[model samples]
Target: MSPGIPDRRGLWVAVGAFVIWGLMPLYWHLLREVPSLQIVLHRAIWCAVLVASWLTLRHGRGWLREVLARPRLAAMLAASGVLIAANWGLYVWAVNAGHVVEASLGYFINPLLNVLIGVLFLRERLSAAQWISVALAACGVLWLTTRYGDFPWIALCLAGSFGLYGVIRKFAAIEAVRGLGVENMFVLGPALAWLAWIELGGDGGFFSLRWGGWTDLLLVMGGALTAIPLIFFAYAVRRVPLSVVGVLQYIGPTLQLLLGVLFFGEYFGPDRAIGFGFIWIGLAVFATDGVLAARRRVVAQQA
Candidate 1:
């Protein structure tokens, strides 16, 4: 294959992954009948199995052994694993509990959160436009908080957990899929125990209940749903430019917002609309700044 062929393929692959991620709330919604915690447990267990099997098939036993042997790495993975599990559980719960719109809002602000984290913890400098974008997003969030008469705990929690997960993963030594597989391993035991309780306590929906074959299939397929996009995403990042991937990342939350309003019929009154508008403006500025900066770098290199 030509060198450019892989890049072209990766673009499509990345788009597919983002699209899948964007529509994931719909998948979670299908399992709304099952308790969110139970669904999360199943997701952890099944995804671990899938990723482990894939790792073994690709790299043999050495990969797994190596991951386990590194104590420091293992510790980081464990922390990251817990954060991701918490993120997954909460997102699923939010979707099932009809908080999809609020959940979407969290992701909408996540990029800005990353910027904030960079400034606060890493002492990174932001451009003037970037600062303006962050300020607009902050104002949007503040408006929502005041209008609701309370903090948006669900949105904040989702953003915080996922942001911290990214931070931990940044220092991790393992590769992406392998790292996720290892992370899954850390959570597997608790997930299994929880599943056991649900099944043995006669309160489970997997086999004992009369849910239906479709539900069973969907639950089993949750593993694929979880891992496939990550695999596609990993593949894409290796082949595409970071800026391209960055822009595409918005697809997930946008799809989620649409699903929330159009499909789930969640509230989108004028007040929330105004708040989201400010945030969108912030994202527009942030994205435009990134594109312009990237373009300037390219031009400088050419010059």
Candidate 2:
């Protein structure tokens, strides 16, 4: 509650959210039999139902109308919705296709990519240390690409789509929950229609039990899985410093990387390790600069 102290409850909440995100690969793995497209559709539909219900209860029907009144904001949310949906689809597909290591690489690259986005699109300037961090991350990607004889497109796409989504949301000027609710609403119709089409064609995994009752339950619970962490994140950011959040964000991908290598048994030879090492060093640099900058600002305020 003090100027510099973190709220203990918020820190825990932030940890919980990132942990859930980190463990998400396991959740999707449970639905491995279900097609990735179907999983994504179910996620979109159920998440929309839950989030819209919450918004309706909290702010009533007028909340949506209020957002729609701003055509520009609505359009931005629509664009963001498509990007997020694409991100979700790609992530789920990658996990099911035995690319979890590469997927984790995407999230690892995300924070640095966000910094690059700020510099390029927002015209923001970075410190020399920040520039070095970006360069290091770039070198990591290059190392993986050249050494492996394969481009890390899956990782790059995931980071790029999510990064652009963040940029759009930055200027959207809406509450996180409300913005997400609106975004879901934009995609809900198409998701529902796709699911319905599949079900009618008797190829759906939901009630048909093609993958059994547990699959059905997981599919439905996907909504809660999708929304709860985001809600927690929204709550946490309001209480904690951005620098703290920046550091905490890595917990998710770290767990994911572990799950990929340890649990999923994906390949991780020395070549890949060297590349990841470069990125990890870059992240360390970026995080240190962020903390020092935050401390400087606090000291200036106190002085």
Candidate 3:
């Protein structure tokens, strides 16, 4: 049987990556003692150190030489670097500010936003169901705004930042590790400069002198976890269909929602649930359309 064609392992790997990433907010919340800007700075700094070390081990000093050889690629990836930095900073800020649940909402909206990005930026056509999905998600967001007495800015920010990252990465051609290396370098300048100034006697409280002690060494693994899954995702993207990957992304956001509501004990009330309802219905439509369209393709092939 050969395990029935292990086709979705790559999809599963990507999903697993999202799950870990989604639940990461809980870990980020622990560093709440640090300013969100500083925490963002740490994410970029640690990511740079981790990726640089990997490149050093793999390529030795020539890693720098390789990067210098591709100045155009480096410049393009620099844009990706800014995108992820803003995404990281916003996510950490959201979690620390007690908006984990809303942050989950942002991820919920990401897929729908991706569709729009495709249409607007790439001039791609949207299916009827996709148009409906976008409308439903927008309506849900609007509903959340109406019920909550304010718009869910955290959710919107999360969706917007990550969605933009995806858009830019699509245009940037480079290997995963090399691309990430350059992207991290984009924020490294501002991140290191900010941290240095804070360390010079400002009240930034730069280092977590008591931060979970040696356990914080595990915290440094944050970059590894971040990068490894991305590598897996890049592999999976080439192997799996985008439609499958899109649905699988829900698993990660779902885990994040659970972690936010259950583990972190963030509040989730009726209005938010209603918003989730709208998003779910929209996904249901989008998924059904994709499945049926795939079936039609198979039938046409046979015909």
Q: Each model's RMSD to truth, in Å?
A: 2.1, 0.8, 2.9
Q: How many clashing residue pairs are found in candidate 3?
A: 0
lDDT, candidate 2, residue 170? 98
Q: Candidate 3 on 12-79: residue-level lDDT in tens? A: 77777777777788777667766787767767888888888887888786765676678776776777
Cα displacement (Å) at residue 121, model 3: 1.8
Question: Predictions ranked by lDDT, top down?
Answer: 2, 1, 3
lDDT of 1 by residue, 1-303 (tens): 432224788899999998998899989988889989989998999999999999999999788779878889999999999999999999999999999999999898998898898899878999999999999999999999998665888988998899989888888966899999999999999999989988888888786556787988898799889999999998898897776777888898999999999999999998898889999999999998887787777777667
Cα lDDT of model 2 by residue, 1-303, tens digit: 555557899999999999999999999999999999999999999999999999999999998899999999999999999999999999999999999999999999999999999999999999999999999999999999999778999999999999999999999999999999999999999999988999898888677647888899999899899999999999999999989999999999999999999999999999999999999999999999999999888888889
Q: What is the TM-score of each candidate against the true structure?
A: 0.95, 0.99, 0.88
> How well does candidate 2 match the true structure in TM-score terms?
0.99
**77: Cα error in model 1, Å:** 0.6
What range of 10 consecutive residues in model 2 has the weakest lDDT sum? 1-10
In model 1, which runs have C-alpha deviations exceeding 4 angstroms?
1-6
Name the candidate that leads on TM-score.
2
**lDDT score at residue 223, model 1, on the 0-100 scale:** 88
lDDT of each: 0.89, 0.96, 0.77
Q: Is candidate 2 or candidate 3 better by TM-score?
A: 2
TM-score of predicted model 3?
A: 0.88
A best-first ranking of the candidates according to their TM-score comes to 2, 1, 3
